[model samples]
Target: MPHTDVQMDTHDIALETPPADVFMAPSICKSDLLAGKSYSHFSPIPAHISDDMTTECVLGVDEAGRGPVLGPMVYALYYLPMELQQSLLADTHHFDDSKVLTPEVRSSLMRKLCTDGSDLHRASGWATRLLSARDISAHMLQPAQYNLNAQAMDATIDLIKEVLAKGVNVKEIYIDTIGRPEVYQKKLERIWPTIRITVAKKADSLYPVVSAASVCAKVTRDAALDVCYEPYQDTAVNEDKATEASTHVAWGSGYPSDARTSTWLKQNIDPVFGWGNECRFSWGTAKELLEGKTADVKVDWPVEDDANGDMRMTDFFAAKTEAGGDELVDWFGKRVTEEMEDF
Candidate 1:
């Protein structure tokens, strides 16, 4: 994939990736998220905005699907007037409807948020950054690793900057943090000196704005997962897999702990490429499945012969041949001892 440069100044928030069925879902494009690339989407700037930079609005950032092994990690931001924070989000719209995070409720809330002329839609604005499983795995698996926390922080910052640049009167910002909440909060404060930034462990459950942001992120991830299997369904390695891959029939929750997901991965993995881009190759479970003893093929990666003396498997075999050593004895690392019982 080519390096994608996001246009920050333009209101054209449509993702630059391949087109998708717009009617499918509001915040998610399955192909875009699972196409081995990361992308961002911005909701249309709310028309109920005044040009006053002094206008006080509260914004929140939250993420979803961070632990899942099969779907995109979505980072979302929501901003609305500070006065309306209670009246609009909490009371009227019920952004904090549930004591626990509920996927079903989030989906329903997201639909309302996206609906035209809805109070939630007309008064607030939002954006999302969908980090694809493939892109994430690629970064972390590379020689110079970029960890998930860093990637997440960058994505969250990008969403906030996008909203700020679009002239949102952001006065206070709240974020659901991954690790080192104080450090994250300080970093965000350094970036936006004027805005009061708050980063908490469960900011989503505590703050109404953060809860709304969580709803957007969760709904986007769930919808993306539903469509993630579409691309691989037709071109599956086997007919049985093709039948099963039709819209996540047995794909499970995309978590490594889930037996159904592990079964799906085992049954559908390609010996050469592992599973499709839906799987995060950087995850320990994925690595073990692809490279461990149970793998269908034991692939030996080619190594460069550097001046410092790098070695390949073939080099060792060749050295044994030159030494006139028995291949079986050397391969098995076995040697007979005088007192050995099983030697």
Candidate 2:
């Protein structure tokens, strides 16, 4: 029998390099490099290359509104093939965790990802759909925390199911760790027993896929807020006169530390839309609402244009009141000058 031996190539393989014009060249001037090349001149490594190992399609998962005093918990999933991922990495060297980018840059990247070759899926648990704030308020903070966590987990599972239904082949999933790493891993494992899941402390910073998902989730949630806020802008302005004028700021990271958001909550807590039912009464803002310390303001409803070329007046009160506090000031604060009670 002839001895068979396999030989490995010792010489370095010549990798194909594109022509100078065809290849992407850094925008730095030669003079700048000669003076002293800064870190910006360094080329970024493509996301598709994962620690010298090429990975199959990877699904990135992220959530938003985790600490918000209002609104629902939003979860998003992004899937990218190795080739397209590398292409995106090569084209846009600035791609990184969404938290590191400014709002304008994040918005731009979000639009690019949605239009570019990436599959996106999102799911949410609106405050209305979950147990009412009143119900949660009936219990202590611990129970409320449990309920919110349950809601978030349910939303995440639903999002994963939606992505799977779309026929995307995802072998591995990466999540930005929420609570304790071990706890999050166990919780995710319990929720998604079939899939291989990894809970990274800062997956968004480490994994390009997770960063892309974060951008998607943040942008989608922001857009939703804009939709919810359109009708309320006029109301916000009107309320500002009676009470402290609200800054009417955009969603400020959904954290309790956001002052404008806290002020908005303080202004809106009342009977028609009290802390427990209307807002996330479980938050500290809700406690403040119950204490009656924040500003008291009400949003104004728009006048309806009827077919008879007249505005609909449901009652005498509607006919008498204006956008300003004229009626309220007269009725509540100051006594009526004349006895018009009979009307």
Candidate 3:
């Protein structure tokens, strides 16, 4: 595929059939606030690296759907032989310059990349961490506070660490970052002193590897968004196979600013529970709709009389013994003085 021009706004990613495989749901984040959880997938080592444990390679990292108020934020890492970085992806496949392809084109490229025995498939190894909306919203909304940036950074680092542990001779790393690139660059450098690392804004446009990673992330998130809509596709589908579901693209780009997304949120929200796990409740858009005048009933959570100070003295000593006793002295192993009679 030749490199095209301009990035589509992703408002109407017309995938006739949503790529359900990418919307993995096996793993989970441990949190009471989350209605759903996140998951990950790591591609098997490429055949090209099977024979050589120390094969020199270059890796790139990028993410998609970070700003969307709906769907998961997918962080992806793609790597291949350092020498083939330019020749194979850039020159042969034209995966260059800011992923200058349409949604269909990107999807097509990804399909080819995933095909067994394909040139790209045999040469490259990749992975993704799909952060579910419920998990993300719950984290950000938690009392301690874990924001998106920290979550993004951890996902990136986890991918790299897994690659290293798998013995993929990573020689250099390139990352597409938002906000202070130099700080991220230095942090990575400190962690992996041996590998050369570059962290920059728009690294996707500057580096072919990052561009390919961008494609992987964007395609996965788009397909996942469609999957997220499956539960709510009732109104648009017909019994006839010939009829297409109008709701396929109804959710729009999922950004808070998108008119279609705003309308969809208004139409689908539950009066009591709000939207499904696909929504990020922490976002101002979702929060406002759930608590604003549009809401059917005002919700007031009951407060405990002493939420933070409910712990009693018994809590500290409960684990020490399991004796039957109503008094504190009887709890202490039938009293030491009675035990002294045995001595």
Candidate 4:
């Protein structure tokens, strides 16, 4: 993956290694939250490079917002030269698994990394794929192409590709996994024939690189949710009420178990659209509310989009044409030809 310089005017927003806040107000489409992808770079103004540089870099991959019913799922990658990985990341900075860290600490560390003068900024580089809720729902809802695991894998791959394109020499990769570690490891090994890959349970806690990636992923997700707000196009929600609704909806952690998230879903569901693009419709919590709680709507399934699979009343009674002979055949054939066109 190649890196791009995303210029941010403020200190709070996540940078690209540079990529959030707790309870921050959602900004309305400041950038495309749903379309395309974003990445960050964190290194000295003139990135250190040498023609004879032989040090292979270690990289880690981790994600946040997977369980959340709302907000984008974030995949982040943290990479630095392999030799300096532990000394700078673990001993110097004390980076650890993001789950155990408080929101304040994560935000603070990410902020420092974004700062130009910091040692962490000079030594490390990171990037993220902000997989939107709308994209996730649309993928899962599609009958033939639906699979969350595959979707996650693709996001990771895209991140790595972007990193390599940006001139990072990643020789070894570590990943924290939600699936069978051996299986995931084997899959990634097959994908990247040359790079050493390890997918493990709690890899984030064990490896500083993975832990760094976790912070990048976790903090980006939190900030994304913090600034998450839907545009006020909905006619049912009054502008005054909608403006009131926008300020801190208190969707705690975006997990289904969070009482605040559940309460927000119930109180804010649109009935017709369910929730804003922030909420994933494929998730059980969102789906159940839309189907069981909202008013019933009659739907015609198996929508006819293609030319095949069309049936008509004439086709149904075609077998009876044998009994009626030529007279019936002529009557039914005429009806079938004209009506089949409509079907």
Model 1 C-alpha RMSD to native: 14.6
- Candidate 4 matches the true fold with a TM-score of 0.73
Best-fitting candidate, scored by TM-score: 3
Provide the overall lDDT of each model, using Cα atoms, as 2-decimal numbers.
0.75, 0.48, 0.78, 0.70
Error of 3 at 98 (Å): 5.8
Name the lDDT value of residue 271 in candidate 1.
91
lDDT of 3 at 78: 92
User: Whole-model lDDT for model 3 versus the true structure?
Assistant: 0.78
Global local distance difference test of model 1:
0.75
Runs with alpha carbons beyond 4 Å of true place in candidate 2? 1-56, 86-93, 116-146, 187-195, 235-254, 275-278, 291-343
TM-score of each: 0.76, 0.54, 0.78, 0.73
- Candidate 1 clash pair list: none
Evaluate model 2: give its TM-score.
0.54
Q: How far is candidate 4 from the true structure (C-alpha RMSD, Å)?
A: 10.3
Deviation of model 1 at 339, angstroms: 77
> In model 2, which range of ten residues has the least summed lDDT?
12-21
TM-score result, candidate 3 = 0.78
- Show where candidate 1 strays beyond 4 Å: 1-24, 50-54, 97-101, 232-248, 304-343
Counting clashing residue pairs in each candidate, in order, gives 0, 0, 0, 18
Over the stretch 97-201, how does candidate 1's per-residue lDDT look in tens digits?
A: 222545556666787888899888877888999999898988887788888888998999898988888878898999998699999989999999998889998
lDDT of 2 at 68: 54
